[model samples]
Target: MTQITAAMVKELRERTGQGMMDCKKALNAAGGDIEKAIDDMRAAGSIKAAKKAGNIAAEGAIAVKVADDNKAAVIVEVNSQTDFLALQDDFKGFVSDSLEKAFAAGYTDAAPLIADQESAREALVAKCGENVNIRRLARVEGDVIGAYLHGHRIGVVVTLKGGTVELARDIAMHVAASNPQFLAPSEVSEEAVAKEKEIFMALNAEKIAGKPENIVENMVKGRINKFLSEASLVEQPFVKDPEIKVGDLAKKAGAEVISFVRFEVGEGIERAEVDFASEVAAQLEASKK
Candidate 1:
C-alpha cells in the first residue's frame, strides 16, 4: 500500500474543504492516489446531498439574464438549504450560468431548462454539500423587454409593446415591490372574485345588518371592486409615484404593460425551524461516536 503523506492530506483538505482526519482517511482509502481521493470525496458529498434532499431549501436567489437587444430575457431561481449557502459566490455563479443557459435556449417552459441543467445541478449539490435545486425559470419576449432585480431575493421581467427601458424597469420594480396578483381586474378569476365576495360579506355582516337587501348587495359589490383594484397591477397605486395609478403611469409613458412575471425566492416553500444549539451538540456527539 502507498504511504499517505502529510502533504497529500493537506492538499485533499484544501481541495474538498473536508476535515483533516476525513481528508487523511480518504487519501489512505484511495491508496495515495489524489485523483481517486477527490472522486471518493465527491462520492461522499453526493451521499450527504442525498441525505439532505428532503431538507427545506426555501432560501435562495434569483438570476435574470436579458438579451443585448432587450427583446427577450430569462429569470431563474436557485434554492439552497440555508441562506448562508445561498450567499456563497459559487452558488450565485451557478445561478447566473443557469440563467444564461435558459436565455440562450429561449425556452418558454421550465421543463426543458430544468432537464438540461440536471447534471450541472447534481455537481453543484455535491460541491455545496447540500441539496441544490434549479427551482423554476421563466422567459419573456416582446418588442421591448425589461428586467429588474431587487438584490438577489426578487426578480421581475416585463414585456411591453413600446416602452423605454426606464419605463419598463420602473414597472418591473413596481411588480417586485407590490407583488400584484393580476395584470388587470379582468384577469382576476371569477372564482377568486366570488371567494373574496363571500369573505367580505361574512366579515361585514353586522355593518349591513337591518339594511335593505339592495343596499347590502351594493355594499358587497363596492367592496369587491375595491378588492380587485388593490389586487390588480394596472389599478395599483404606482410604487414610485403613489399619486398616479400604474395604468395611468403607463399611458403617460406611451406604453402599456403587455405582460410581467415576478419571482421571489422561497415564496412558497415551507421552511423548517432548526434549533442551532441542539444541532451543534448533535454534531459534536456524532463526531465522538
Candidate 2:
C-alpha cells in the first residue's frame, strides 16, 4: 500500500468534509489512492443520505431570479433533510441553477420540470447526498414577471399585463409576505367554501338561531361573504396596508395583477417523521463497539 501520510489524510478530509479519522480509514481502505478514496467517501455519504431520506426537509430556503430585459422570472425551492444543508453554499447555488434551468426550458408545469431537474440534482446528491431535492420550480412569462425572495422557504412570482416594473416588484414582494391560496374568488373550490361555511355555522349556530329564520339566513350570508373576502387574494386586506384591499391597492398603484404563484417550500409535500432521540441512541450503541 502507498504511504498514508498526514498530508494525504488532510487533503481527503478537506475534499469530502468527512472526519479526519474517517478520511484516513477510507484512504487506507483504498490503498492510499486519494482519488479512489474520494470515491469511497462519496459513496459512503450517499448511503448516509439514503438512510435519512425518510426525514422531512419541510424547511428550506426560497429564492427568485429574473431574466434579462426583465420580462420573465423564476421561483424555486431546494429542500434538504435538514436546514443545515439548506444554508450551505452548494445547496443555495443548486437552487439558483435549477431555477435558471426552469426558466430556460419555459416550463410552467411542476412535474416535467422536476423530471428534467432530477439528473442534475442527483449529481449534487453524489457530493452532498440524497438530502437534496428540487422540490418545486415555477416560471412566468407574460407582459412582465417579477420576483421576490423572502429569506428562504418563501418565494413569489407575480405576473402583470401592463404595469410599471416597480409596481410588479412590489406586488411580488407582497405575495412573498402574504401567501394567498388562490388568485381570485372564482378559483376558490366550492368544497372549500362549503367546508368553511359549515364550520362557521357549527360554531355560531346557537347565537345566530335566537333571531328569526330570515335574520339567521342573512347572518349566514354575511358570514359566507366574510369568508370570501378573507380567502380571496384581491379581496383580502393588503398586508402592506390593511386599510385597503389588495385589488384596490393594485388599482391605486396603477397595476393589474395578472396572476401570481407562491410556493412555500414543502407546503403540501408529506414529510416523513424522525425520532432524533432513538436515532442518537442507536448511533451511541454503534460507537461503543
Candidate 3:
C-alpha cells in the first residue's frame, strides 16, 4: 500500500479545494498519485473544477503587438518572481521587447526569441535580485487580425476572415474577457465531451436514477450541449449584448472567426509558498551562533 503524505494532501487540497480528509481518502484510493486523485474526485462530483488561472500564484505580465496593416499579431508572456518586480519599468520593457522581436520575426515558438533576449533578461534579474523568464509566445495571421490587452495581465489575438478590423477588435476584446477554450462547437474534442458527460452524470446521479433509458440519454445529451455552448466562443453570449450569441454577432458583420490565442500571466505555473515567519526565526537562531 502506498503511504499518503501530508504534502500530497496539501497539494490535492490546493488543486481541488477539497477538505484535508477527503483529499487524503482520494489520494489513498489513487495510490498517492495527485493527478489521478483529482480526476477521481472530479468524476465523483466532489470537485466541480480544478484550479484555474485565477488561482495561479505566479506573477507576470502579458504583451501583444499588432501589425500596421492588421494582418498579423503576436502575444507574449514574461514571468517574474514577484508582482513588485513585474510592475517595474525594466521588467515591462523586457516584456515589450520580447513581444516586438517575436512579432518582427513572425516566430510562433518562444525558444529562439527567449535565447535572443537572454542577456537582457539576465541583466534585469541581476538588477532586480529576482528570477525572470520569457515564458511563451504565439502569433496569428489572417485577413484581419485584432489584438487586445487587458491591463498587461491578459492578452488576446483574434483572426477573422471577411471581417472588418473593428469587428475583429470587438471579438478580441470578447476573447480577453470570456477566455473561451474553442473557436466553435465543432472544435471541441470528443474526449472533452465524454468527460463532461461523466461529471454531469455523477453530479446528478440521484436526479437521474430509475429514469427510462431514453430519458436518461436525453438528459445526458442536454448536458453535453450546454457544456459545448459554454466552452465554445461562437456559441457564447456576446459580452456586450446578452440577447445575442457571438456567432450571431459575427454573422451580422459578415465575418467568421478563424482562430484566437489568449494568454494570462503565470497561467499553469505553480509557485512555491513561503513561510516568512519560519524563515525569520531561522535567521535569528543562526545569528546567535
lDDT of 2 at 60: 73
**Highest TM-score, which number?**
1
Clashes by residue pair, model 3? none
TM-score of 2: 0.74
**TM-score to true structure, per model:** 0.79, 0.74, 0.77
Residue-pair clashes per prediction, in order, are: 0, 4, 0
- Lowest lDDT sum, 10 consecutive residues, model 1, at 45-54
lDDT tens readout by residue for model 3, 91-148: 8888888888888787997999988998787567546656677888888888998888
Q: How are the candidates ranked when ordered by TM-score, highest leading?
A: 1, 3, 2
The residue pairs found clashing in candidate 2 are 61-152, 61-153, 62-152, 62-153
Write down the lDDT of every candidate, Cα atoms only. Answer: 0.84, 0.75, 0.84
Residue 91 in model 2: lDDT? 81
Candidate 1, residues 135-164: lDDT per residue as tens digits? 888888888888899998999998887768
